[model samples]
Target: MAGVIQEFKEFAVKGNVVDMAIGIIIGASFTTIVKSLVDDIFMPIVGLLTGGVDFTDFFITLKGAGEYPTLAAARAAGAVTINLGLFINACIAFLIVAWIMFMVVKAMNRLQRKAEAGTADVPPPRQEVLLEEIRDALVRNSTRP
Candidate 1:
């Protein structure tokens, strides 16, 4: 138990674990922002482009209640619905988020490559004095023989 606790403590103190935790927290927050951007900004524009059809309210009730027309009504009456519009909205949001992440990662990779190329520290070629002396001795021996 003590060994396990000590190992956990060491792992927690490591920079990589802390960095990963921070990244996860930031990613969760970023996801909220992305969701808002999609729902508030993009969805409205899309709705306008598609002649003001609201995607959130669009649903096909499997069991039709003739008097209750709205999706909320069908949902309230325990009617099963295929929410295709909401699914489309979700897919669009997912694609947008995926594109944004791709751009961010692409830029990061570009910068990383540039930084690595700029600061490359290849060791200088090696030369051994003893090896040179050995070569010279061989040459001398060959000439004598």
Candidate 2:
């Protein structure tokens, strides 16, 4: 139990875990912003483009009263719905967030590689300079004799 507790403490204290937690919190907040962007801005424009058809109301209730009318109506009546349009909305938001995060991670990796490459020291190749000089001297002496 003590070993487990110590391990947990070590894991929690690691920079990577802390960074991941911070990232998750930021991601959750970012997700809310993205959701609002999709639901409010994008959907309204899309609705106007598509003859004022509200996609959020598009659903197929499995067990409920006649039609259930809208998403709010279905939920208010406690009806189970497929809500495929809402799923599409969620997918759009997820894709947008994922693409943004990919760009960020790619830029970070490129910078990290650049920083590491700049700091790394590459050694020059070695050669027998002293031995070559000694050998040349010995060869000249033997030739003179």
Candidate 3:
């Protein structure tokens, strides 16, 4: 039991675990922000361009007899509907998030490459230099004998 508990503690405290937890929390928050941007900001502009269509209220009633002006009306009247507009909105939000993540990963990769390039030109350690010199001396002495 103690070994299990210790192992759990170690796993919980690992940098990767902590980082993943933070990433999940931040991702949730980012999703909320992106949803708002899609529903509130982008949708409004799109609606204007398309002559004031409300995407959230757009739906096709599959069953029940009567016209529903909006999704809420359809729900209130107990009409089954296929909310294609809502699905479109969700797709747009997903694309926005994907694009932003792609840009972020690209930037990170570029920075990492620059860091690697900077480190590549560094000289070898003094220990390695001394070891190589010793090896060369031994080789020279062996050849003379």
Candidate 4:
């Protein structure tokens, strides 16, 4: 029991675990933003361009009869519906999130490469430089007539 508690403590305090927690929280918030962008902004524009047909209302009635104007009305009428428009909206949101994550990872990789390149440009230690100079002098003297 003591060993399990200690192990749990170690895992909880790890940087990776903390980072993952933060990522999950931020990802939840980003999901809301993406949903709003797709539903409220993008979909409206798309609907306008497509002749003002609200994608949210695009559904196929399976069980209930009679024509309904909107999804809410169909649901209120106890109709069985396949909400393909919601699926389309979800797909758009997923693509947006994917593109954003790709951009973020690309930026981080670029920054990491720059940091590595900067480290590689640092000069050698002064002791190594002096030893190289001494070695060159010795070689010059040995090769002299």
Two-way TM-score contest, 2 vs 3, winner: 3
State the lDDT of candidate 2 residue by residue for 74-128, as single tens digits: 9999998999889989998989899999999999999999988887865433567
State which candidate, 1 or 2, has the greater lDDT. Answer: 2
Put down candidate 1 lDDT per residue, 72-126, tens digits, no spaces.
8878888888988789778887898899899999999999999898778754345
User: At residue 117, what lDDT does model 3 achieve?
Assistant: 94
Clashes of 2: 0
Query: Per-residue lDDT tens digits of candidate 4, residues 1-145?
Result: 9999999999999999999999999999999999999999999999999999889999999989898899999999999999999999999999999999999999999999999999999999999999999999999999999
Sorted on TM-score, highest at the top, how do the candidates line up?
Answer: 3, 4, 2, 1
Can you give the TM-score per candidate against the true fold?
Answer: 0.74, 0.75, 0.83, 0.82
Which regions of candidate 4 are displaced past 4 Å? 127-145
Model 4 worst lDDT window (10 residues): 62-71
In model 2, pairs of residues that clash are none
The best candidate by lDDT is 4
Q: How many residue pairs clash in each candidate?
A: 0, 0, 0, 0
lDDT of 2 at 67: 74
Lowest-lDDT window of 10 residues in candidate 2? Answer: 121-130
lDDT of each: 0.85, 0.90, 0.95, 0.97
Where does model 2 exceed 4 Å of error? 120-145
User: How big is the positional error of residue 34 in model 1, measured in Å on the Cα after superposition?
Assistant: 1.3
